[model samples]
Target: MSGYAYVTAEGLKKLRAEVEQLERIERPSISRQIGEAIDKGDLSENAEYDAAKEAQGLLEAKISRLRGILANSRIIDETKIDTSKVQMMNKVTIKNQKNGAVMTYTLVSETEADFKQGKLSINTPIAKGLMGKLVGDVVEIQVPNGLIPFEIVDISL
Candidate 1:
């Protein structure tokens, strides 16, 4: 499916760094492996050559995919995002209706999502349901288990 990829400044930086590493370090390392494998003798029986070829293929695939992602990425301005409404880059606090449990999550781009840090991807079910919701609004989200109701308690940058 074709869709826009949103990314934060930090996420963009990380992507650039990764691309640089692949070009500067990983590319050369993999090339060296291939060269050494070629020097080892027969290609049909050389396991090292086969493995190196596989590794090079995987690395090239990764590099291509990442480049595509970067090309389509749109960097989000955290400060300019609308806090008045639930949107990308907004830190939203919600309360579960069933258990009265409160949770805080920053709605971010797919690349920026780090669940351990409470940063959720905008593509997530919960985040999709939460988008455009206002504070004090009760949002009902559909999940595998069923529908979950949550009240938007707060929103910030």
Candidate 2:
């Protein structure tokens, strides 16, 4: 069975905005760069031409992947979420059972997870272990370091 991609409405909107930006600005800019490089003459030894071509290919691939994600995106309705249990779109606060350190993370889709922003992907080891668990329950999660125990302190929208 294929896993569902749980994304927030704002995250989906951002993806759409990025698609528009690539179509309107980035694609044209790359095309212009390629054209200018081509005008510089020798295609065989032109480093600029080669670089531009590579960039264009990478850009197209990125655009394609983004479009695919947008096509498959399921925007999560945050308002309808049940705050009784840990689920997608839940802001969960967990405390390390061993160390007594607490960290709060918002479980989100892979596309919506920004580690820098404290959002963890639903597919991640920690999030997967926490899913469906209730508050006050300790779940053992396997990280690269090894399995560690974390107690679910709270769950909220």
Candidate 3:
């Protein structure tokens, strides 16, 4: 995708929803907690007020980070994805040369990655190694565990 971060419509929707939830729901909840802590009196020694302030800071930071990701990443057209070579939004199946273990992952932007759902970030070593490789092409990826060879079994939408 021309060295740009690409996110799917679903991912974009999720990010937007999260921002909404944070701003509308979580923000109000935290504000209420802070108000309650203040109403309890003695602000200088109030643990609840300090905890609420810390949580507010963390939540604001997270919201800002998520918004930045939303602003920087371009939404991908899923239907136009090419399977000619491994790239973003492509579901790729690979087989380990040494252990014979097969794994499938959909390459996506870092913001959209959910390893539990087989979404692998393009920034990862394995995804970087398979970036432009075609089916049947073997690639050696250097992960934290060390270099391991993998054969591209299939690439699909």
Candidate 4:
């Protein structure tokens, strides 16, 4: 899981911004909380000190994880993407053959996957099934409910 994470320029920028926010704002805030906790005497049974320490540990771990992702990330040029077939960063429109339901999703890297925004992770079952598939290609994908067939309606940038 420590391999390179290919991301769009915007995705990379967002990641960097999140990291900066955690480091510059969150880190100092946690430090201040710990310091204020220390101002209160008797650290042995201090709930505020314990809570602050726990929060700091969680934040540091999160920062470390994000840094690791950033270290291994590579920006993917959106202009170089192909539309002939399904691939990373491509917006794909698919139709469910069984239920005739049409849905569109933008296949993206793991870090940028947000289903609510129609961004899907390439590692997902639907995305995996759609990889390298051309428009009008029908693919049978195994989903949580059961196996469902989907036809590639369109592929775009």
Q: What is the C-alpha lDDT profile of model 4 across 1-157, one tens digit per residue? A: 4789999889989999999999999999999999999999899999999999999999999999989999999999888999999999999999999999999999999989999999999999999999999999999999998999999999998
Cα TM-score of candidate 2: 0.94
* Model 3 Cα lDDT, one tens digit per residue, 1-157: 2344578888889889999999999999999999999999999999999999999999999998887887777888888889999989999999999899999999998988999999999999999999999999999999888899999999998
Residue-level lDDT tens digits of model 2 in 1-157? 1455567889989989998999899999999999999999989999998998999899999999888888777877778999799998899999988889999999988888998888999889999999999999999999998889999999997
Candidate with more favorable, higher lDDT: 1 or 3: 3
With a 3 Å backbone cut-off (N, CA, C), the pairs that clash in candidate 1 are none
Clashing pairs in 3: none
Instruction: Return the lDDT, model 4, position 92.
Output: 99
* lDDT for residue 74 in candidate 3, whole number 0-100: 86
Looking at candidate 2, what is the lDDT of residue 85?
90
Point out the worst 10-residue segment of candidate 4 by lDDT. 1-10
Estimate TM-scores for all models: 0.89, 0.94, 0.93, 0.94
Give per-residue CA lDDT, model 1, range 1-157, as digits (tens).
2677899888999988898899899989989998999998899999998998899999999898888889998888777888889999999999999889999999988878999999999999999999999999999999887899999999997
Full candidate order by lDDT, most accurate first: 4, 3, 1, 2
TM-score of 3: 0.93
